[model samples]
Target chain A: MSDYMKRSFLVALWFVFLTFPLMVVKVNTLKNTVEWRWMNMLWVAIGAFVLSLLWRWALERRQLKNKEAESGEDESTRLGFGQRLLVEPKLYKPVLAVLFVATIAFPLLFDIYQTNIMVLALVFVVLGLGLNVTVGLAGLLDLGYVAFFAVGAYTYGILNSFWGIGFWTSLPIGGLMGALFGIALGFPILRLRGDYLAIVTLGFGSIAKIVIENWEEVTNGAKGIAGIPRPGFFGADMSITSATTYTYYLMILMVIFTIFITNRLKDSRIGRAWMALREDEIACVAMGVDMAKTKLGAYAFGAFWAGLVGVIFAARNTYINPNSFTFMESALVLSIVVMGGMGSIVGVIIAALVLILMPEYLRAFSEYRMLMFGAIMVLMMIFRPEGLIANVRRKYRGHKVMTEDVNA
Target chain B: MPEITNKLLEVKGLTMDFGGLRAVDTVSLDVCTGEIVALIGPNGAGKTTFFNCVTGIYKPTRGDVLVHPPAKKSQRINGFKSNRVTTIGMARTFQNIRLFQNMTVLENVMIGRHCRTTTSILGAILRGAKTMRQEQETVNRSYDLLEKVDLFKYADEFAKNLPYGAQRRLEIARAMATDPFLLLLDEPAAGMNPQETRALDELIVRVRDTEKIAILLIEHDMKLVMNISDRIYVMEYGKEIAQGGPMDIRNNPKVIEAYLGEEADA
Candidate 1:
């Protein structure tokens, strides 16, 4: 099926799923008060879902009709600036920019829930950027990057609880630990390339998880760490009780910092080195690039970011258990890089945001969403293996004056 | 004293063995300042094996490659260490053009300047003015190299996308980007037509004279070798059969026998 039709079908499935939870009879309240099921809640949810589906379907139909009408017109017509932007640009950047700006200004304009989702999106953004350095730039297949994320979380948890180290101090230390582990993981697998490398890295990740689980002396085993300290600035506690406003602002600051640094690294000499290595290691060595150092740099840098974000993740949630940093998490992050378009910073961000938020928007579809998502991935591979945002080097070009601007 | 120009690269008593078969046996040669030398021989004559030994791709079983960069003390180069070779003022192209398939044509050349790039962690983060200036200069230098080889038009094009002739020229341009004193070209005219080969001969001569870079090329084309080389070393069965100017070697009976027979030269 066409992407438009598939999207509608997904929306319909989401609508049915969203309303299913409302069928539950009675629910207990937090204050020990009796709470009765609200009648018509399912009906209302299903109605909303159907309405959303129709609205989305209508938009798609309208877009298709407009496309047909435009195609029937004369070919000699010149494209305007705004029209060119719409057709030519990858929708991710402008959309993300808008979302970013909105999230920053959200506390003033929107409610708390919107701000929370923004925080969630920001976390995935960091993870996606880190994965991009590994699976995208270095062309290393890492099916277990979240092991480093777990290391960061446990580092923060243990440091704050035992050593009295604040979140601020523990963050860098956590990143360093991640780097150490990353190097260790990278060294043994240096000789293994392609699929062999993937399997070994995956094995390393499982070993990390098993160690975390069994290391009851440090990790507290099945029961995860709780009451992890939040970040503080200028001796002012950044706890929820201190100020919700400051916490939201801090999240924004962190996301912006991640984006800026990732963008910088993506265009720098080191970034180019990574690309050279990915394209051909033999040629890269011939160009006088030290293979071991370059590969290690990717591992260390990627793990560092994941580690840093894990620190924030621990601080934000106030609780983190071993179960949270599973292979599924790594798979989700890897998929974001894959679906976005490998070796693209902007592409990963879009993938993270879309893939992360998809379940949230359609709560009911969360269960079967993965199945449909897998199907989409399969179809994408068959049709556009370049990912959702194809031709990262340049956008598609139509056979008109409109072609020049989009491609550029 | 003829200036007593220093030897940049010296290969002494080099031997490569494939099990019991000795490909290159005790072959020694010196490449001094500003000379175009050709290593010519019949197929399976160990010309390439000798080139590989000197370029640090293959460790000789019993010999040393001493590279002295214009008054610097000599240092031994180990095998399969390309970075060391590049650092010691040597750059070489493979018989099979090994350009990065996905990278841009400009990127391929810019990678040659990797050894010269000296940016700090902070510099990369801020992309300091110096870094920008250096990067621009590197780009400019790469463009100049490409222009020298007449491939400036395909600067942004992917390396693999170029036509075969352009790819060969690009390989030469990439080698030139390293600013090496010795540029090794392995079978550069291997698949070229007569017209292209003629252009390559002129290009090589121009590069030798104008760039002041010493070149050691391996070419099967006798016409190319005879016309361009200041000196040619003829090889047979892993040993240097004869080494002299093209005319002297051309008239040598040993070279004649290696090619046809002893009676042909007589």
Candidate 2:
């Protein structure tokens, strides 16, 4: 180990030990008796400092080794999966087949409880991708994205209850209604940028929730319209278990559809324009992109999926209330987009799966879940502020601009 | 497409006021078909402000600006939005290169083709034959523009990853993708070495000749301004000091004193 790093490690240890009295020590008062445990502080300081220092050392070592390896190697001859897929296009079919098989067998592989968790996670994957479009691709930093979710749920719920409309009929109307709300929300906020935009969006979400809570005549107020019909495909029994593997299958299909559209949009002109808008609004306008159209498109498209997924959420539970659509829901979707890295489509999916499922599995550790979330976020910001899975272009774009002239 | 006989751009008494100060003081200039016009001034001389007036970045406090696109009739274009200005065949590059930093080079150029193409959200979603063809053509045209600027090789690379000189060229390539009849370049040669400036000089001439587009550039680089420009409009303190050929402006004492010092013009 280098002497500088060793000294740094020692300094870290010394600083941690010095802070034990404040950071680790705890005092408790029980029935007028104040008990202090400085021994607990000493042990905690020693354990935590040692573990952290070791982690830092290992991380630095791996980074240093990676740098050396990269410096020594050339990519021209490397046959990684990306290159191999290019070399043999048929390789993708097998990969797709495997995924299809896995998705088909997922419910059977797990018990009803676990299957329910999988369905919920997949639903979030859809929601996360939808939010990803607004916050990730458009760089809009939306705080009120859940408003669209609620609108979709209510649209479906009201139509199903009053109009006797089936899921198939109301689906498009729900999405279109969600889209209209998205456009409505987007219109006023088009001129606002960054933090101001974020605040306004957060207000929009709160407004939607408050309206749902207080609008007793329409939404049944806090009681919420109960007995919302489940999605029925030609009278096939919709209820099998908690999620009803049928709804799970249908959700998987919806997720696939969302992926297809999102993927298509990402590589298209409108997608490029959205990216330009995110990167530099001035440049986007100068480049002749219709800012109004691009911004609205992002909001509508994002809200479409959110609305669709909201229908699924309402149907799956056969009930939804104002409590289901909350700020925390928006925050969870936004965090998935953030931790996945802004503009990373696949990263959002992975993050959505991990984030949604982690809490489910950690119900025993529910007390620590939020604390862990805060710690993870803080550490992420401190260490890899870029993201857990940075969009490839974003990762590559930060490479230092070349100075030497090409013609010279 | 050849440049027709009509003047491509005509700025008549364009004045821009910024809170009691006239940033651009009645700057009248004209660019004929296939001409290269240079708006030369030292820092704070309102050259960019003048460009902004014409390009719709700022609505001129007062004055009439006219644009005559080939096949289109001449029309007063004051107060048109920047995108509207672009659709009328006026595309511009920033003095500070504003290439979408996270986007690929090809994508950056492709964005410039946005106004030229016709694709709504439904078309984009469905990706029907017409939209597909338009997209493919846009890709092809962007590549062609990149090739003209000698940047086709770096098409897949992020715009921000390019060398400074390459980035400048990329900005020009992006602007050219708009298919503008009158291309406005804001200090295209800024930060460029002598060799790169010479290359840029050749590029301006080439773009004007091949594209048959009138070029207007605001530049501090006297050598480049003098070398490529058919006519130069010298401005100082928000007012035009001289408007003539390079040699004519070089000898104009007011132009010499206001901006181009004896050492600079030499």
Q: What is the DockQ of each candidate?
A: 0.23, 0.51
Best by DockQ: 2
Q: For all candidates listed, what's the TM-score of chain B alone?
A: 0.93, 0.95
Worst 10 residues of 2 chain B by lDDT: B257-266
Candidate 2 DockQ vs. native: 0.51
Residue A339 accuracy (lDDT) in model 1: 87
On lDDT, the leading prediction is 2
lDDT of candidate 1 over A20-98, digit per residue (tens):
4555344556676645455555565556556666667666676785586567752112333333443455854696589
Against the true structure, what is each candidate's TM-score?
0.80, 0.90
Instruction: Name model 1 segments beyond 4 Å from true.
Output: A1-97, A106-117, A233-248, A390-408, B1-5, B18-21, B236-239, B248-266
- Deviation of model 1 at A314, angstroms: 1.1
